[model samples]
Target: MSRVILVFYGSYRQDRQGIKLARWIVEALAARGDRAELVDAKAVDLPMLDRRHSDYREGEAPAAMAALADRIAAADGFVFVAGEYNGGLQPGLKNLVDHYLPQFAWRPAAVASYSAGPFAGIRAATAWRTTLGAMGMVVTSTPLSLARIGGAFDTAGLPAGEDGGRLIKAFPRFADDLCWWIDAAKAQRAAERPPF
Candidate 1:
């Protein structure tokens, strides 16, 4: 069976470049036959963190929050496409995720970080690792970082020019790592009950 993976992008910038990276991640994962969906923070338009989805009583959560919680709970894995802001997580993505806890538990999570500068959002990726781990996800060991986001790819997420070759080469290993964990987790979930 195909795994449903949610690729999240949390940039609300007037001129967001990280979106290219996000598109690339979703498209690339799709090409590998994973059912990948892009969950844009801006498009999702969730209000700032207040009442979490878990806080609401049954049938009481807002329509948007309830819908998103269902999607998150059904997904087998996740990819957080982050753009660095002052060497940390982007508010849009962080706020989107902060609304849930149990929904993210026991899943494999990956980080695909990018930036306009040379660092490729590595700092944000580092910080996000801690947060994802704390949220109970089995964060992937491999990370994809793209520097100079503006020139990395077109809207379709295809790699561009000199960077094309590097990205093409890097994606397979990253996907492989995530897939391995996904398979392992699925097998374990089927074989035994999770310890609460």
Candidate 2:
């Protein structure tokens, strides 16, 4: 089965809109019989980049960075559920994204953003999509959102109306597209001869 990593990129440890969205995405992905791993950025002790001035390579990086990269490389695809901070992607999410470069190559990615205000992290998602695109990731075209999250979501984590149905409907297509891209990338990589 294809594996997809769902990353919840919020600083909050307790239940929040981003985490809630991540859970739903993971559940939706799992329901399709795919392997979905939900990774919380809070749990990953990410520190600022500590690269040496002379050493351009990140050889033997800190355990947290190494683990973060492993999760990215292990999955055939990724889903990001992130919170908006100052009308942009949260610091935690940016830190996680900066940890790896080429390792993210050609993998598929989807993003869901949430915020209390009108934009609903749409600007943040746009920023994140650009960054991921530079890493050669096939970021999903359908960006999901829960605008005015404080009003839209109940304490139980359910969205308020049929509008959420549209969001939910978009998720499966995103997942299916990721699956397709992953399979295609794997096949293309395998075809390159390196057998010894």
Candidate 3:
């Protein structure tokens, strides 16, 4: 079976909660026959968009951004693990999404957000939905939010609370949805190709 590539859209720094969540998810997806890869926004060298060449059709996106677009184009699905910033979406994630709009169309997307607040980063998830929806991606409803993320991860690099169990349970459903959509889209694309 071909594996679905999961994209972790967050900072790569070791101490970051979003990164931790991304790691856990990638591990879980790997266990489920999916080839997961984290698109660490921090490590990616995406320069600010130069106004003159930002459009996909006519503009030259930065090398890093172009590489990211290529990755998205190849992936079967996407899992966005994001961190909330002042009750909104993270700028780094926004930049990454902004740079790769054309390539993300019709892809299946799942979002995970982490924060130390009560809302559990749902606000960030909503913002992410709007952004991904604008790009024509199908957003999954099996969303996961890690509240008080600092206390959730153990010394062994695993989620140590109920949140971890919740994430584990949610993933299979998300994976199911992703596979369904991906296969359907692939079939549709294949049918649309004219035989020569």
Question: Which structure among the candidates has the greatest lDDT?
Answer: 1
> Over the stretch 1-196, how does candidate 2's per-residue lDDT look in tens digits?
6556655465554545567677777777788887787777677766665652123455566666676676777777777787888888788777766766766776778788878777778888898888888878888787787676655645676655654665666666677777777677777667873212
| Clash count in backbone of candidate 3 | 0
lDDT of 1 at 90: 98
| Regions of model 1 farther than 4 Å from truth | none
TM-score, cand. 3: 0.86
- Which ten contiguous residues of candidate 3 have the minimum total lDDT? 50-59
The count of backbone overlaps in candidate 1 is 0
TM-score of each: 0.96, 0.82, 0.86
Q: 44-160 in candidate 1: lDDT tens per residue?
A: 888999999999999999898899999999988999998999989899999999989999989999998888888889999999999999999999999888888788886566788
For model 1, name the residue pairs that clash: none
The candidate scoring highest on TM-score is 1
Q: Compared with the true structure, what per-residue lDDT tens digits does model 3 show for residues 9-88? A: 65534566677778888887788777888888788857554431246454365666667677888887888887888889
In model 3, state the lDDT of residue 61: 58
Alpha-carbon error at 141 in model 3, in Å?
2.0
- What is the C-alpha local distance difference test score of each model? 0.89, 0.71, 0.74
Number of colliding residue pairs in each model: 0, 0, 0
Ranked by TM-score, the better of candidates 1 and 3 is: 1
